[model samples]
Target chain A: MIAAPDSPGLVGPVVLSMKMAHRTHGEGATAVHALRGVDLEVRLGELVAVMGPSGSGKSTLLNLAGGLDTPTQGTVTLAGAELSAMDPRARARVRRRSVGYVFQDFNLIPALTAAENVSLPRELDGVGTRPAREEALVAMAEIGIEDLADRFPDELSGGQQQRIAIARALVGPRRMVLADEPTGALDSAAGEDVMRVLRARVDRGAGGLLVTHEPRFAAWADRTVFLRDGMVVDTTGGASGPESLLAGGGRHRGDR
Target chain B: MSIRHGIIALLAEQDMHGYQLKVEFERRTGGTWPVNIGQIYTTVQRLVRDGLVLPAPGERSDDRADVERFTLTDAGRAQATVWWSTPVERGAPARDELAIKLALAVTAPGVDVRDVVQAQRTESMRALHDFTRLKAAQPQTDDLGADLAWSLVLDHLVFDAEAEVRWLDHVEARVARASLHPRPSPRPTDDPAAGGAGGGRARRRSGAPPPGGRRR
Candidate 1:
């Protein structure tokens, strides 16, 4: 997917962060063209929600944006580095140093204790055990789960396990986070707490992209993007507030 | 509106006992909707608790007994209006998860196509039988709403189940015919023979390779 091209010279450390412009996909008769064309720009300190129905390609867009999937044809750039142009090894390094992820299922190692699970990402990035454990503890403390660090996944309830996942995703050298259906499994009360934590992360200057089915979850984002049949159907909270843009009535802020 | 709102809406016109409310609601729905007696009682209890409804002048006082007669309050009438006026966003139309799973299951190596069709066919038949039995036992009432609404749902459920069964039979026949013909190598993506070979290339290109040469 990623083929690193020769670095284009003359731009001194371009800092606008990630940008994906006009991505398209399709093939022959059997080919279902998932994404028509999408343009997105993510700078620092922003939280965006991607909302759509089952087959609308929000996941496809997320995969492209997070370096989990590639565009059939388009440019994807992150931190002045062209993501679509990078070799596999170099792309891996970029992801390790720049991105974090929280999945709907929590994705914690079931056999490991909370601290051990939290430490796995840093360890994967080659950070040693002792220091990784210390970092993990701090991250767990931030998410209010420091007391549960010694518990295995089965010992904790769903909400606690998700908190541990959040800590794990945040404990490394990552500047951005991609959460796919992060609150989908939790009940309303627990989901609200998790959203609060994510909102705090964005307030602290790390950008986030959350893909979800629930309208209530989208209410928390700085901006919301709605997709339909693999196209960007609507955008809310750019220059106009969500009230005007989401007035079609499918979704609106909880504040209303 | 909550379930209480639903009950309150029904009561705004007059007082009703628990059984009367259940019968009336079903009648109004044209017997299409079967309201559980338990749900009717529960909603009545909640409405009483909220002061949306009050027991009639000479009704049973015991909480455990069925609400013999209950009348809606002014507040309850307002609540009913809110229920009627407010609009709710609908979730996506239901799709068959089983269908997607079965379609993908055919590409798995060592899976027999005939077995897949037979299993789905059997399941749909059982579901259709259950639906048929319920339709036979439907309450006989002249209530227009109850009569029309239930008939519509029953018709659709039967139609969908029968259609699925027919599709499964056609698929089984096609698979049997293809089995008799000379088989060609499957495409790397859709063919079971290609299995692990084409698995991770898309994921690989999407991002960097996983640690220790593992693909994510």
Candidate 2:
């Protein structure tokens, strides 16, 4: 039962917050409810894994939380700032400055080296080239891949490439990371490596949301939320330990 | 089961006494399967009777002597070599209590299969966590053989637990589907998107291709 510490620097319990969020697509006869009144609060030093069958609104929840998409009904707050209230440009700025994203595929640029791939985000955020490069090197070192800094993504193995992608996600002062099946492309050993990196990152006071189909990968998270039919049907709270599964019966059928 | 061949294999490496064999076996296997001294002596006596092992030259003939070392015979060497190359037999499925329990629960009256599955899942997950913690506590050693052997043991346990969890999920899903349709029939829809009302909604939301098509 590892709980997030109550730090004075933070405003409240949650870091990237969502409250009664709902997202509906299209109009009238074709309206599809992607997410229905979801309330999630990921605190600092927490990695929450979203687990569900295909098309269960897991990605929609992530998109809303990261400000890539807005909720139709409720609000999302990231780092104490209300994302729904912010304009598009302001939201984009917040996304760049505070949020990090890791896609299923290793989205590293083929032309850029590992260091350059990691530093590109920082440079885009108006960081000087030297400082960005330094930060990228530091991040690469953190993941034990500093030696691969100058190597292109093609030269690295799948595990190495994923590590570089993680380094990219953690390059700046981003407080929240959203990973969509980051281990999808990796083997079990490689997948565990990526999970270890992500877990270490979250343990260092960054909140993360990992979307994974594999229960083994989800086991690494602090908690797991099971989504079905655009709603959270079950939640394994605090720690994704075996005891949590036994604490509640099958499908609590309520919102958290 | 493997203790027989394991002892033979260690003897093939060097002549060792009973206590030394026990210590070496535990060291190589990361102490996961501790060999009792009585078991070692019994196994050694059996091997001796089978002519796979012989007392080393200059060693006393007394059975209780600690300094008396045993060396592998030609037959033992050949057997150990075969053990190295041959795979473990898996034709006869092992009798597992959990599997038996689940099978009984499914057929037993007044028994909730879901509850049984949930309980087993929790126990398996707890075992997985304990194994993970034990693996983490192991100090990294320069002896690659021992390190690899220990890691393989840990991996076997982890994979087994993961498979158990997956099996439980499958069982729960099957039970749920059966309850939904009293008379079970083949699933109607092959298209995952058109499988059910919820599936249709999910497909409409993310028109992007499903998580398939990538190399598993």
Candidate 3:
């Protein structure tokens, strides 16, 4: 773990921000720098897609954004609180209350029914069971899967399971969704369905940080960040990416 | 599908004049690929000559009859069925100028292949982003059956642009890896510029279209 000092900055309506964040694994001769000080922000109602070739730090960035991993240097702000400065207990509480995660696989519990799986996070945050279930239903209905709430994960199709997973990610007081290739396991049509649901949720004010290499899925985001050799190299639309700095002279991206 | 088949497919639904056919084709395909009125009339005249369609009810026989509604004959209907049933043949590679340009760049002098790749990638991503913005503006109402054609055509552009970007990335990686070591084979023995002709870099253009090259 790295020690974090609280720094003055206004993250504003942004749900997540990573300023000069670096994550290096191991040490000395074999140190692998997963991220080399990348700055990013996911504002409310914006879905930012991270796209790069293999080993370009897409997954590492997602982990740091969701507070699953701490940065080696720089601040990670989630919901206006600096994650790197928080103690483990406080960080976990913020992650449970403010952040929702969706992985490539559905990641639903096999034993629990869909409703229970969706409600589990709320329950873990100390909400009563009945209220948690009600929130779960609301999330499912938001994604148009209220009818499949009682079924177990194994019984549903991949697309249905993924929609349920998205509902779980959107449930309760969660203000941000961190999805790592949320459509990777499904076919093109089913993948479109997943992207649609994710985009709809983001449009309704839940910030999204989506990691995907597939350009079609990446298109669902408001902007895209391209990483190369553990650095931000280019960005398309709505991103003040590091590339503008790398290119020398800060030209307004709106003119690009 | 080719414009020929597209016209036939649309006509199978109902008889339409040339302007109507052009508008319908563009409408069905999201207006991404536009067809000129002259091209449509020329193709229709050829279809009539081949007995696949005929000018309806007291219209001129020449192709200048743009107002003449054309109806599909049985042969045209059969062609429409084939177009609908058969998957678009994609086994054979098309003539790609980008592939050719990149293939030349790795071997040419005075050209940074990476820059070439990166520039092309930026262009492709820009196109992909534009298509994505257009898609977001397009309505995706629940009656997808009516909107399926438009959506599919729009996605075709997005997917193709996406593939182009991926291919460029792959090319960049492979070129970076290969250029690490010098070529093992002997260099070309043409002596014109081999011995430092003119004591300056007198290399020919690395990536320029020569005379009579394909423009479009």
Q: Estimate TM-scores for all models.
A: 0.49, 0.78, 0.80
The TM-score obtained for chain B by all candidates, in the order given, is: 0.51, 0.78, 0.74
In candidate 1, chain A reaches a TM of 0.81
Best by lDDT: 3
DockQ of 3: 0.17
Candidate 3, residues B80-179, lDDT tens digits: the string is: 9998999876665666778889977887777899889877776676556655665665567557553777678667767877778878877777677667
Q: What level of docking quality does candidate 2 show?
A: incorrect
Off by over 4 Å in 1: A1-26, A239-256, B1-216
Candidate 2 runs further than 4 Å off: A1-14, A19-33, A36-39, A72-75, A230-256, B61-64, B100-119, B136-143, B173-181, B184-216
lDDT of 1 by residue, B1-216 (tens): 134555777898888988889888867644534568899888888888998888887777677466579888888888888888988545554455666666556556788876676566544544443343344345434456655576555546556665665566556544555567635534445545644754634532212233342111
Q: Which pairs, if any, clash in model 2?
A: none
Deviation in angstroms for A189 in model 1?
1.2
RMSD of 3: 9.8
The lDDT per prediction is 0.66, 0.77, 0.80
How far is B111's C-alpha from truth in model 2 (Å)? Answer: 6.4
Q: Specify the highest-DockQ model's number.
A: 3
In model 2, how many backbone clashes occur?
0
Q: How many backbone clashes can be found in candidate 3?
A: 0
